[model samples]
Target: MNSLEHLQEKVNYDKIFDCVQCGYCLPACPTYETMERETHSPRGRINLVKMVAEGKASVEDLRDPIEKCLGCMACTTVCPTNVQYGQILEGAKEVIEEHDVKSMAQKKVEAFLFESFFPSSNWMGTLGNATWLYQKSGIQKFVQTTYLTALAPMRLGRFERVLPDLPSPFERAFRKRRVLPDYKLRTTVAFFTGCVMDGIFFKTNQHTVELLRLAGAEVLLPKEQTCCGALHSHSGKGLSAKELAMTNIEAFDLEDVDYIVNNAGGCGAKMTEYPHLFEQGTEWHERAKEFAAKVRDISEVLVELDGLTFTTPVPRTVTYQPSCHMTNVQRVSEPPRMLLNNIPGLKVKELNRPDFCCGSAGIYNLVNYDESMEILDLKMIDVIERKPNAIITTNPGCLLQMKLGVERHGLEGEMEAMHLVDLLMEAEPAAK
Candidate 1:
């Protein structure tokens, strides 16, 4: 009983009840738009949570609709009444895990892999080095269609959604002069190279560091850090997520860094939630809280830095796609835009329905391909209508999904997709 209670950590319910049902968040709510169901809507989920609190509904009633949610917190951003719905959903997941416990067999398998595979540089490096080989051989399909589905408990999306064609790991890139020199080192930040980002989008991480160094930061790469626990948490293996967080807390605390900045929005969100996974708190709990407090989205850090004067002349309209985790979970629209606008001669045009999810909710694109495609189609149409020269976003998932989507739908080469850091790097320092 104690253990179960510990799992369902206490949440601020009073804040949850403050939602005024204004429906302002509806426009930003992706799941609501996808299903058009009350239960999937933010208001409806809060209602279910209220019922669950009152013992009027079982955890089973809250299972499917809630699980179907992408954990996007766009609803909270638009809510004038100040409902912290994201925190509520994460807390609700804990409660469901404690009481309901459905899908144990599948979750058990995921727990094993996420805990084992993502924690070490060696394991991830080997796997990163193998992705290109797998694609070279005709064995990619069998591994993609059969092995991944069979070995793993769930699907993230279609074949293209989660396919990270990583040639070299981010660790190797960092180890081989992937950074620039910083004179002052105003702040030393540790980058959490998440699984997919570390492997496939290694250049993005490099760009992130370049941007950081340009902003007067000395970036530290903690060689011991793991997956940031987001993969395990999303896969219904909260225990593994907790263990991963503990490992990260220890590794990150090693350096005398000012803050931990993550390019991956999912990792940033998870790092911010580390404290909630604890019971009544000890020294470790305090340590996790301190780390969480220091966690910063890459944009957040870049925007906050002094002398981030941009010299890159975009000279054309650039559409911005905010990741669901960054937009909803982290509530970071202004920082990204602020940084983008800093670039000389750049026009920051908003994507139609900018807050809507791109349907690449972490692994959601891979497992729920049909729904994911539907969402991405909506976004693609919006992007094509704008006719921007480039689409800059933060998350790798968005880059992948948006890239694959535009190509398949024959919008190929019409618009380019890249990370905000990629553009930030183009901003040259004032010439001596």
Candidate 2:
């Protein structure tokens, strides 16, 4: 007669049992290593879900462990049984969102982010404009110096340190546009300039497109595409993520392009997994599969092009931080390094535990500040030890998190964090 016995449709009961609990994932899991608690590990979370399915545990029992997860998917990389831990985590999240109790503030923030800002580029632009003015007008400086952000709600104070300056003059020029290569185009691609990638990390997107052009590919920024819905899907809003996927499928003219380029690793991973969102054999499902097939990380696309050449000498020590989505989800580990190695005189230092999460698992650092900082500090330990002039990564979230780490460790004078595409563009001779 337990409520958990009547498992909801959202919970994948069978998948929950896939975990053999052999503890293979223990060393690979960041949260488990940090918290040293059984509840925060993959095996523990999978067991909790299975328990809920079997009426041994309640939805409430699953909340803390699931929420604490970085969703880095490092466990999946080592799982011998091929357990789709990411899928299980997503299902568990859906179940939590539906039945778990949430505060009014939590509900409001989710609504604002998923419903209000994430679905539309206009909202992103509007917010981006305000942020631009805040930085430009010196108000941000005044507030930071005056400690006024401490008075703001929702720990906006700590979050403010992570905000990067918005790109000017170039922001409007890059929106929903197309750029043709000056040379004979080897191929054509549609670029997925994501919500956060476009607004906050706008310059990275620009550099991504420029790199694509230099590699001899025609780039398309289709006007009809919307947010990649990575945040929504990661947060358990499956329906919302599906809606955005459908809109994007219709947006890109797949007939005309050879690849759908995604510079942001998180978005690339989600977009490439679009087929899983729809039931097999549905029309939308077929479309999702086709759309997903074309999605490639910008690094992957760049590596595929044979015409790439770097005349500019970067001549700096650099380390690479692989986004969880890029390494684990997208299964892309080498293309960025291969690209980096291509640059003349650039010292590509291998970061110890390159696959570790930088504490910026999407909005993770924002919601779970203390825990996020713990992970970030661990990451910084490796970063400071490596002592690279710059840390390059494939996703916007990682870029911001590493930048924050630089700021937090007072290493602003010593090191910088940048996107892979930005590094490539900088190393391009024409860019000099």
Candidate 3:
């Protein structure tokens, strides 16, 4: 658990009562599927939460099960009662953070990431540049070849392998922030380049912007925008999340843009739920709703744009692993499929569990690597069986997680992982 506070005050007690315990969510939950225990299921987790809220069970009793949840919201897809389990889990996480105590190292790392690193673009740029240097300077090659990287902590060592090559300096990308279409701008759209998205998958974002431009939309990359605070909210730091939401609300001039476009499913989902971050009847709440109203996933925007067609053919048998946030929260399963199917020669195969969580629930894979890998291994069985040439995903975390799965199963020679935006860009005539 992130924190172990009383939890009663931190959560919406009434939401717990909304679950009908119909067992429909059990099969859909990755943890339940992995552990095959009721405690790990959504129904069991809700009941545990209700017990804590009612003071019948201590917070300690519910901590393990609650913390183990991937927060993927797959259960909600099957719920008959329309239970908002994701919100409930977020509330539970908040209470845990408030009450659960942390060790000094934990506290320091959390502070460094949440406070110092994420909120500032400069810090992220510096770190990204350092990572680039580590690779470009040949130090990374030396460490990997000498097996020195293996000496690092397990999670850290694994995370090192998953790190994508950093793009050129942020300044280079920022220089091309505002892009205009060749003929005429049908509409002007703001692109929400997320913190990690901009830092790590820089080329993907660049491709997204170019594709949007090709679709005749003027893309605006807001300079004042910061991290989406999804990680903070998931970790139970609601205040930090709210602060970041307000900062974003202030950053974007909503009236000037037709849509606030996001390529990352997780960031897009969180930004779309900005209204939930604020209180009812508050000014920020109203602002949040207005801001969220304009928010659209890149797929949502791309599929709707007229005259947007891929002239370059991509000849590969591709299967999509829809990011959990995209399918369940953003409610965007079809737009990507519709867009991919538009490609002339591309074969878009459907995975057995397209919406299944890749076990890359934000930082869940890092903190719970063993259990995460367990869930991922299950997903990989289906992925490997399907035997697609490339696996495409909409979010960075899912992209990395899928890559990790390919590496772990020694399927690198047979399959490759790619971001959807990158895939589309590869199928664009200009890219050819």
**Model 2 lDDT tens row, 1-432:** 345544634677777667778999899999998999999998998888888877778888987788789999999999999998888888888887888554344465577677768889877877777888899999999999999989976566766776878866456655547788787778999988898888787778878888888788888888888899888887888999999999999998544899999989899999988999999999989989889889999888878885678888998899999999989998999988998998998998898899889989987776677799999999999988888999998898898889888988989879999888888877763421
Clash pairs (backbone) in predicted model 1:
155-367, 156-365, 156-366, 156-367, 157-365, 157-366, 157-367
Best by the TM-score measure: 2
Candidate 1: what lDDT? 0.73
Considering only N, C-alpha and C atoms within 3 Å, which residue pairs clash in candidate 2?
A: none
What local lDDT does model 1 show for residue 65? 67
Per-residue CA lDDT of model 3 for 161-247, tens digit only, reads 768788766544455768898876778999998887887777788888988888888998888898998988887889989999998
Angstrom error of the Cα, residue 240, model 3: value is 0.3
Candidate 1 lDDT over 33-69, as tens digits, reads: 8789988888888888777766677777877666767
What's every prediction's RMSD, in angstroms? 4.3, 2.3, 2.9
Give the residue spans of candidate 2 off by over 4 A. 1-9, 103-108, 169-176, 430-432
The deviation in Å at residue 130 for candidate 3 is: 1.1
Instruction: Point out the worst 10-residue segment of candidate 1 by lDDT.
Output: 3-12
Which segments of model 1 are wrong by more than 4 Å?
Answer: 1-24, 52-55, 95-116, 119-121, 134-182, 307-312, 426-432
Candidates' C-alpha lDDT: 0.73, 0.84, 0.83
Worst 10 residues of 3 by lDDT: 1-10
